[model samples]
Target: MMNDEVIKLIENRRSIRSFEERPLDPEVLDKLKRLTLRCPTGGRFSVIEIVDQSKKDKLCALCENQVMISRAPGVWLFLSDMERFYSWMKEKKCAENFGESLNKPGIGTFHLGMQDAIIAAQNAVIAAEAMGMHSCFVGDIIENYEEIQAMFNLPKYAVPACLLIFGYAKSIPTSPLTSRPEPEYVFMKDGYKHQSVDECEKMYEKNTVSFRERGVLPFDNTGSYIEWYYRKKYTSDWMAEMSRSVGVFLDRWLSDEA
Candidate 1:
């Protein structure tokens, strides 16, 4: 049934930040969990679900004090769980549980957990879209990683990867399908070839034209447009700090398995 649903869902999905105080259906929630597990994972990953309002309340603070996220009907905090797998390894007496040994192509279970969490999170967005829900990703959750992780009291090697917040819509905004580079420009045929400066400039001009047609004011230099968005988005210093913190946490997560 769901295999047939992707076509419509992909066309309609949009990130939504605002929400009303409504809850999602229990059955639908169950379906979401079931299908999420069906997503292909990289390796032994752990599942950490937080559905209670008590937990959701802290998320608002965790999201750099975002005022609106906790109000979302469905939210998820995906973690790359090394500790959980370690416990499972001890219980199951399987090397793969702790993580693949030093002979593997990756950081064994740690990378797999991140992969699985990403797939599951993406699947959640798709499923929610099919159900006529709106969603926004919470990249800012890591801004307060220490307190946020402490709120959940996460164990060692268990860290927040990303968050997804979804809700039923009051009124869908007539938002444009965000401009993106042409598929050929970004998608290489093979290997990691990059677009040249001229190519980048052309793409920038294309976006500028598109923005002006949409009546987005001023029609000034693209750098100003980018900087405007940059200021609004990366206003907090925590973003850069969190990135460094994540690198450390990831290194730690991979250390044992590596």
Candidate 2:
């Protein structure tokens, strides 16, 4: 079901942050856009490419000052859009109840939209990598919900799902492939399998050690890498801010008045 070229592309793809200071070839960019559109969608979603320097700069700030936003040739924002569908329904004089259902979507609708957006994003990244280009997914696009919505002039049912910045890498990445847990640890047989606290710790220990060795997490004499990681990442200010933003966005996006 898989070929060597496709397998190699998947294996070698990595998140590239440092990009060369240049624009992508117009033809190549156009081809990439076409390839991305071929990705599966649940009948709603849109991809917007941002090339304006002023807008990119504002986006960089909104995304917690990730300099890669400013360095990349262009950024693609994937939106979970129901506005177009709503407009069509209005023009066709759809039933009031049917229109109201779409006007006030629930959590399941959000999940479907987010899944579609992310799937399209992965397709875009893989296509870019195949063409000798690099890309990184910016989940932080959802951090400043209100500001981002206003900046993009998004409609009520349209929400920013994710961002992918694409460009040529300045140099090859030197980092080794990151390790993952064993298949048994993550992949359950037929149904869900809940692990105990100790089991969870064991599964994560390898990654914790690797992070410390790579100097990503400062090593203290205590040698509790997991503890350090939880404090540094899970409990960080940015994580809290992102959580708050998600809640606020959900409230507004799913509101009947939205």
Candidate 3:
């Protein structure tokens, strides 16, 4: 039912961690930047493309020393940025109209900005894949929240939403594409359906098998994949830090006293 260029592109896309050392063609890079900016947005956001070795090194450290950050030849940080808008409002002398309330962006603004940034980042990733470049989304940039903000000298209203690393693929993957939940398990005909434990297990059966084959699951496989994944990801120290950092960013963005 779906046989088209877009469908083929979507089907072939994969998370590529390794990349070639060569730089992207200048024209391609420029087009990518333009395409990212053309994405739908609720409000203004920002992009910081890191090509400099020094900055990439710093970003690598901030993203928990992910070597891929430094090796990818390009690292793009998409940010939920209200700083420019706020500054513009102040420069236009409209800050007094909203008074102190203008200083606080509130949760709504934050949510909008986050959506804008993430959507734009996804656009860039897809565009890169079409242009024959592979990309990986590193969400760990939010883990070192304060340090990342300091590294970029970002204001309270400007928060990092995603980090994208892209370059020419080192090699095409020989293995089959990763498995996913069946269509029935993922899509709903009308309303949401909360699956029972057995249904959930059945849904994850393929994923569990694939992970085990790929050596992604624990060696011992003591408990169910759900429990293993929950402890490894949801309750891991990295996730804890990410949650804490997001909380701090949210507090700063919504704090009228700040």
Candidate 4:
């Protein structure tokens, strides 16, 4: 069984949009940075803590005017950074021994970097919660890769992995926790289990009911909650842009055009 304090902390975690008009305590910020760095990683990750209001405003615009970006007192951008590692290896003559083909980053490197950065970001989230702060993830930060890369002057080996903002919540949330799929459907016994459409609907019944109650489902009886979300988020223009942006960034990372 989970510890009572751990259970309570995980259960209470939620995305916060509204924050009080104040900065984080200096001691808390120091601890937050330390906690973020302590997470496991395959390689080093870079973190950019945004304190400059001008940069925050630009980031807000880049993320499709998510007003919360501007309002949050603590903003951070996490990167799957290989440039620093590559430079170190070069300085130590280790990278030069491998030659260009073996030294340049590949798809595997990118994946590892993303894992390291995202893990660090989650660590920051949990640590912030423990310190009496709230946080929200800004996934749209991946939608404008070129502009963001230019803004931060990122190298080809450093890709944006996650953007997180933290602050003290203005009010406690009263809404129920979002529903999740049943354990049977999520955890397989041995192999992949493919369910029929009816089974899928059954599995998502709780989500459908919750969405309907919150008025998130479409007014016209066009489709189920899953279909509505598929159209609303999965196939949205912003998602397409995110795909395009990431493709561009990947191409640059994989290119040999030093």
Candidate 5:
């Protein structure tokens, strides 16, 4: 059985859009810092920044122009980093080029940094909820990733994972908690066997009715999910341009060193 504190937190963790005027208690803020520090790092350390209303509004505008996010009062940005390791290694750091340094962390450092950053972000959110606060995870912060790098003045090695918003709760839906596919279906006992695209669509189709009831626009199938996602996220020229440019920049950056 889940622990009492964990169960209560899980039940209370609601994704809130609106908020009360109160800022979080300083004691609660301290707790989040401690909890996040214990989050699994995939063996690599990361830096996290908690954002305020002014910065959050600016970031929301810059990232996606989404007014909803611009209105949130508390937010945390999880960033993946490799430069910090290089700093610790001091001048002794070898593999001067990015691509060449892939082996430095034993071939999995990059993934570890990402995984660690995300887990830490989740910890902050869950802990915030346990203290009677509400939160939401905003993935839009990276939609314009290059802009994100520039906006934060990020140097060579940090990538933002997500934005975790916090505040006192206002209203939340009374809808049934969303269901997952059978545990057996989602949990693999051994090696992975990939499913076909058509078969994948079948599984998605079964979830569309529930999604609609939850105010999710109709996604009758995976293709429909694709259509809606593309329309909302990919159609923006600025978003696409930034995405392509960032990929090119990172590739060139990686190409420059070992």
Candidate 6:
């Protein structure tokens, strides 16, 4: 059973983008770091803090000019790091087979690292929220992969997993809570089951209605809500660019020939 405080914290959590200008207290930051360290990981990961104004500015540019990144007092870059393990293997004179195991991490390894990093990031977010701070996850870190690698001087086996910006929000949230689809739509009791088109539409109706109310659809005539979402998101130029970046990142970081 979960405690009331914990349930309330989960229910109240929101993605905060607007932040106050003041910096976070060092003690609070330290506590957040400690909390993040407690998160479980497959092996290990690295967390880099960005406090420099110039780097924050560059990051803002790299991440689609999302000014909230620059505004946040604390910016954390989570990385999936296999380089540290590789170094340990080298130092200990580990077998060549063991060393070669991660020479070029495949999809399975990539997923493990990504999951580890994400769990840590979430821990950091919850910690910040607990301390009366707010945070937003910036998935755009996937873009400009080469520049990020060069900027951080990352080793071949280390890759950016996500970005988290934390600070005090400019104001308390006044908007209504966002709706999520029912568990049956996503959670399966047994084997995977494919949802029919109509079933999918029914499941997504609430979100689609919300989007329509927000006037997000370009034109009112844009077929179904799902179609409008697909056109706006899946077929967008930014999505294409992000896809290209992912391909390039995989080639550079996980190429067996390298």
Query: For model 6, how does the per-residue alpha-carbon lDDT over 99-171 read when each residue is reduced to its tens digit?
Result: 5442444566666778898899999988888888889999889888888888888777778899999899998
lDDT by residue (35-81, candidate 4, tens digit) is 87788877658998889999999999999899899989999999998
What is the C-alpha local distance difference test score of candidate 5? 0.65
The candidate with the higher lDDT, 1 or 6, is: 6
After superposition, candidate 2 runs with Cα above 4 Å error: 96-103, 215-225
**Looking at model 2, which ten-residue stretch has the lowest summed lDDT?**
97-106
TM-scores of the candidates are 0.79, 0.91, 0.91, 0.93, 0.76, 0.92
Write the residue-wise lDDT of candidate 1 on 71-182 in tens digits: 7777788887766656665567676656754232236666667777778788778777766777788787666666776788877667777788877876677967666677
Candidate 4 overall lDDT versus native: 0.88
Q: What would the per-residue lDDT of candidate 3 be over residues 101-156, giving only the tens digit for each residue?
A: 44445677777888999999999988898888889999899987888888788888
Q: Residues 98-190, candidate 5: write the lDDT tens digits.
A: 435534333255556678788888887787776777778876665666666777777665666567777777766786655555554566668
Query: What are the runs in model 1 whose C-alpha is more than 4 Å off?
Result: 1-5, 92-108, 204-236, 254-258
Q: For candidate 2, lDDT tens digit of each residue in 206-238? A: 877776676666545345556776887689887
Clashing pairs in 3: none
Considering every candidate listed, which one attains the maximal TM-score? 4
lDDT of 2 at 132: 92
CA displacement after TM-score superposition, residue 254 of candidate 2 (Å): 2.1
Worst 10 residues of 1 by lDDT: 217-226
The per-model lDDT (C-alpha) reads 0.69, 0.82, 0.85, 0.88, 0.65, 0.84
Ranking, TM-score, top scorer first? 4, 6, 3, 2, 1, 5
Model 3 residue runs over 4 Å out of place are: 1-3, 95-103, 214-219
Q: Regarding lDDT, does 4 or 5 come out ahead?
A: 4
Kindly provide the TM-score of model 6 when superposed on the true structure, using C-alpha atoms.
Answer: 0.92
RMSD of 5: 4.7
